[model samples]
Target: MKVSIKHLFAAVTLFASSTVLADVLADIKPLQDRWAEVNYALPEDDREKAFAELLANADKVVGGNPDKAEALIWRGIIKSSYANAKGGLGALSVAEGSKADLEQALKLDPTALQGSAYTSLGVLYSKVPGWPIGFGDNKKAKELLLKALEQNPQGIDPNYFYADYLAGKRDWAEALRYLEIAKAAQPRPGRESADAGRQQEIAALLAKVQKKLKK
Candidate 1:
């Protein structure tokens, strides 16, 4: 078989891409696991240090695959989580970096990880302060979360985040509705830790909403 130079170059490019993608996935898996552990299981006092370690690892992943949206998404997720753990004026600086990473990820691939960039960005917009203090916009939060739901209508994350947002807006009935949907969400195979943690959150929020209804 006589392989032309163009065909050989194409084959090499495809193979390299696949290999790099595999490497990126491999790198991210452990980072994800550690992040879940730090966020959900570690004591609140210890979480800052643990998240800092994850941030370093996540940075390496992003550095290795600067153009890969998956890397950027994970980096954003880790940075945001780290910010939440830190929780102060300084935390906002970290969150701002996270926001940039997520926006870039959306630009690179809106559908990566089933629109996780949208889901994460939605969470950020909903939680951060609005206007002069920060860039949080409840309206934009709803829009981004709705886009996430359009991509993964039955996804636990989009449902739960949206529910949280509604609860913040004092829409108890709608919030409870989505919380129930999140409670009934099917678990992800390799994301057991995250799923379990989120379920705990869903249950707590569900209880709070129920209490609110009774008031």
Candidate 2:
């Protein structure tokens, strides 16, 4: 029997895509549990199918309404998360869709949903790496994260995301500041313990980053 490299590559790609989808869905399960009625019990592969349904539904809804904005935001968010789950497969579609949804949301009303549009963009940017992950814009990520914070100075979501961003840049001090700020916000049960564990992880990573910076 003869082996073809192309076939091997295809198999690997399929495997990798499957793995990413599994992991992303796993991560979302908790979030789904937290948001009971808002989330559905659909398999990962059916996410795009759901998005198509949502887009069709949105078309019937009135544009420029707060409700419309909310619908668009969530549609975009689901697409983004699904794309992420697929490890860049359909990522361009997801990123573009997310932007369009948020754009429509902003056009409807920039202040709608407590600046959720900005927060969603920030989430998209933070998770999807810049220049490599199809449409990750770290600069825009920072700007949107800041907007989210300004919109809700008392929210933990923004703080947690911003802290994650700061950690990505290896800015330990700044990340620590944001993490500490997030600590004061309402935490999920045992989240404080998780945060403490994460703190230790950050400390370890920062030590390496600092050492590399020195050399």
Question: Would you give me the overall lDDT of model 1?
Answer: 0.92
| Every candidate's lDDT | 0.92, 0.63
Ten consecutive residues with minimal summed lDDT in candidate 1? 20-29
**Which prediction has the highest TM-score against the true structure?**
1
Local accuracy of candidate 1 as per-residue lDDT tens digits, 9-101:
999999998897788788789988898899899999999888888899898889888998889999999999999989978899998999999
The number of the candidate with the highest lDDT is 1
Q: Which lDDT tens digits does candidate 2 get at residues 85-160?
A: 4554556776777777887877776665567788878878777656654677889899998998898765666776
Candidate 2 structure lDDT: 0.63
Local lDDT at 70 for model 2? 57
Instruction: Note the residue pairs that clash in candidate 1.
Output: none
TM-score of predicted model 1? 0.90
Model 2 pairs whose backbones collide: none
